[model samples]
Target: MAHVKDLWWKTVKGPDGEPTQVKTARFGKGKRWLAVWHDQYGSEKSKAFKTKDPASKHANAMETDVARGEYIDPKAGDKLFGDFAKSWFNTVTVDPASEIRYESVYRLHVGPRFDKRKVKAIRPSEIQACLKELEEAFSASLAATALLVIRGVLELAEADEAIKKNPVKSKIVRQPKWQGRDVKVWSDAQISDIIGAHPAPLLPLPVIAAGCGMRQAEIFGLALEDLDFRESVIRVNRQIKKLGENYVFALPKNDKTRTVPMPANVAIVLRQHIEESPPRDYTLPWEKTDGESHTVRLLFRWPTDDQHVRARNYSETVWKPAITAAGIIPPPAADSRGRKRYETTRREGMHQLRHWYASVQLDAMVSVVALASYLGHDPKVTLSIYGHMLPSADERSRSAIDNRFEGSGLVPDGT
Candidate 1:
């Protein structure tokens, strides 16, 4: 049950023994009307209003909401968004790398805007405005990640009954849209030049990337035992990834361990590489930097250090130099301090090898499902990315008709 009380006046027995209303001692001090109700938990809750009608309506609405099992404590969302978001983030379980990335995005992008605000005070328009600002200030991918973090926080708030609704999910808020560019695959000549330009000891790095479609990290973590020459399949079991400042051996991206077919040429190159350079044993923490220790006979290592390859160091010192020597990119220019600085984009990275492999597979008429399995991608995702590289429907139809008509005396006749 809910009721409204007049805080400015009270009813009492008069001198005539009849009930009469009179101003209370606290009259003219604070709101005149109070809406008081018991919540679903049977706990008293109240709101003050300057008018009697609004207070009565609020009390009635509270009673109706409680009866309908849709009640939310108005004060519950008074918790700061930063506090609730941090607590919610701690409860989230993801891969160590992803967890670190989420934390960074929260701290850098999400926290600055909403940390000090109360959860209930955030509105859909405010979220939309924030997203627009993020879109302007960061890359589309980062903006999307920021939106994801915000949504996760608010969704948990809603689930915990701390907020009446998740503003991030409101119809007024729109997620950042990312229009992915078509993958531009490198030509066979370019691949050959790049591979040929690599120093003899690192020749197999680009070969494996172009042939097996292994990611750079996966290549860094390649182990001798994971290669099966007899079966001609590379077991992609683990990858070396950075957890903060320390490197750790972790499962491949998406926690999926898959087997990719090894091309004959790739296997031959690998054998030659092993004969010349030989695999080196290295130990690293498993999953987390401080987790259990694990060792593997890695195929690639920094030449001087004879240790696991650091991605940044390898990229700057090895991969970029090879590409530059191959004429894929211009030579490094000297900065004001006479330090060599190369103008390189992600387009010139080893990931281009993956695009080249996917293009080769698609051009060879491999099925999308099979290519997806070989590349450790979802079938739909593979199709979305490499579908443009596949033979067009019109070309396929023409080929089917031409093959059916061949040797059947169905040549085109001049009209």
Candidate 2:
């Protein structure tokens, strides 16, 4: 049986034996009613409520849960959010990069607010508030990622029965609208200017990216054996990725190898690049293991060294300066003490070249399915991202409407 106890006040007696009402320690500014119950394991547990009605209600529910054998000890949820999140992180399996991203998201945004909170006590309102705060503090993508990290931890807690349900579940929290860059594709003129501004070793990078739509890492990891001049195709099987201190050869983002066709110009550029300087053996660890290593004949080599190009080093040194030189982006302004600090480049990454390729495919009237296959993207993704660039369906609709009226007298043709 469950019960609620009244937190009574003591009565003070006057000298004339008249009783004067006085508040006790239990009656002042605290929960007045105590809900007491025994768990299925015969352990006494108590919770305080501000009023008798709520206390009685909770006590009865506890008894009902115990009788139905659905009772969970509330103590199981006493673990703090930070403590539980750490354990939850260990249990989940993700790529090394994703694991690092999750940790960064947690440390930067999620940890400071809710790390001290109990898992079960976190409410949907609290989660919504946190998301709103994140929106104010970070970019839309960062805020959304932080919410996902929290939801993942709570989901693990729910699976473990630490909480009845995930508080971050449902439509309570919403991702803020992207307030960053417009989804832009560079024009052919702009592409030429940027590529022309690039120096040796970095010159072929833009041509391959715009021509084949290969990702940066995939291009960096491109091997001599993977390219076929007769077939005019590039076999994209692996990409170079940094796993901690060592670099590894990992499968492409979709985990699928594909053969991308190249134009005659792209083939010519590759031929010239290879004739000028041949591919060298760049060794990296195997993707699935740390102990074993292998070497590949990489097409692009760092100017100072014979090693394969690192994306970070190349982006900061080669790509950004080239784009700025091409007048595609303004040069970084000098700061105090005559130091120049660069803000993040605006749509100047290798992905912009990929977008240009997509625009080219769309402009050529390639079907969405075929375009998706060529780009190594899902059909829906290709449509969602680049579908707007397809030749205007509105113009076709207008032509059809004009043709319908051309032969009909129901209304004056063009009217």
Candidate 3:
């Protein structure tokens, strides 16, 4: 039960056996009213007020909150956001690469603004302001990542009862929207030229990417056993992820291991590539750089040293030169010291091959659900990213109606 007490006065028994009010010894020394309540754990909690009415209302509200199972300890939120976030991070479980990214965003963006502030002190308006500042200071993708880290920390605070609610999740706070540009797929001629420019030993790299829609990292981790020629499907099991200076084998994105159909052209190319240069046994740590070692017969490796393919090295040396030779991007310019500087953006990266593959699948009228499975993405995610590439719905509708009415008596032949 909760109630308010008048600190200045006390009820006592009078000579006539009736209750009477009397001044206490320490009357007028402090706040006149005290609101008293017990928390869910039955621990006594209290607050002082200058007057009786406000103290009574406070006590009533606390009682109501406790009855409704919404009790929040007033002093629990005094812990700083940074301290809570650090403690919360220890209980989080994510892939190593994602863990690294979350830590970076927390250190570089989230911590600077909210670290010293108490968890309960963060308001939705302040979170909105922080998001606006982040959008102005960084790319939309990076700002979105920062928002994720902030929300994660605050959600834990709410769960721990350190805060009544998460400000970041409040309705007033708006997340930064990513203004993603339409995916520009390379033309068939451009694909042909790029594939033709690769060295004979590595010619199958772009072929597999363009045909199977595998990410660059997934391609790096491709192994001989993953290819099923009889079934004509490629089992996407793992990817090569770089953790600091070392690399490890981790499951594919979102930990989804899917099978993508292998085209006849892709299978032929793989067979020929295998005949020319067989796969070699390669070993790398699993998940973490210092984790248990795993070995597989990888199809792709550096021809010179027979080592695993590092993305940066392969991009600078192999991918860039091939694209330049194919006229997709201009040749590199030489600096004063004669070092070559290639002018290219993410648009020209091997990911373009994936865009090309998606466009091809959409043009062929493949269902978005099937394509999402093949690409190892959620159906909603695939729809968002590749929806624009789908053939015009209006045209399909027109064609369907025309075909249905043409043979029916509903309309007289083109009338």
The window of 10 residues in a row where model 2 has the poorest summed lDDT is: 174-183
**Which number leads on TM-score?**
1
Q: Top model by lDDT, which number?
A: 3
What are the per-residue Cα lDDT tens digits for candidate 2 across 26-118?
A: 667678888889998899888988889999999989888899977867778997899889988998887776777888889978999889999
* Stretch of 10 with least lDDT, candidate 3: 174-183
- Please, what's the RMSD in Å of model 1? 2.5
lDDT per prediction? 0.88, 0.83, 0.89
lDDT value, residue 182 of candidate 2: 54
Task: Give the C-alpha lDDT of model 2.
Answer: 0.83
TM-score of predicted structure 3: 0.87
Tell me the spans in candidate 1 whose CA falls farther than 4 Å from its real position.
Answer: 132-136, 171-178, 405-415
| Cand. 2 TM to true fold | 0.82
Give the per-residue lDDT digits (tens) of candidate 3, residues 55-141: 999988988889899999878898899998898789888878888988998888889889999998999998888888888777666
Clashing pairs in 1: none
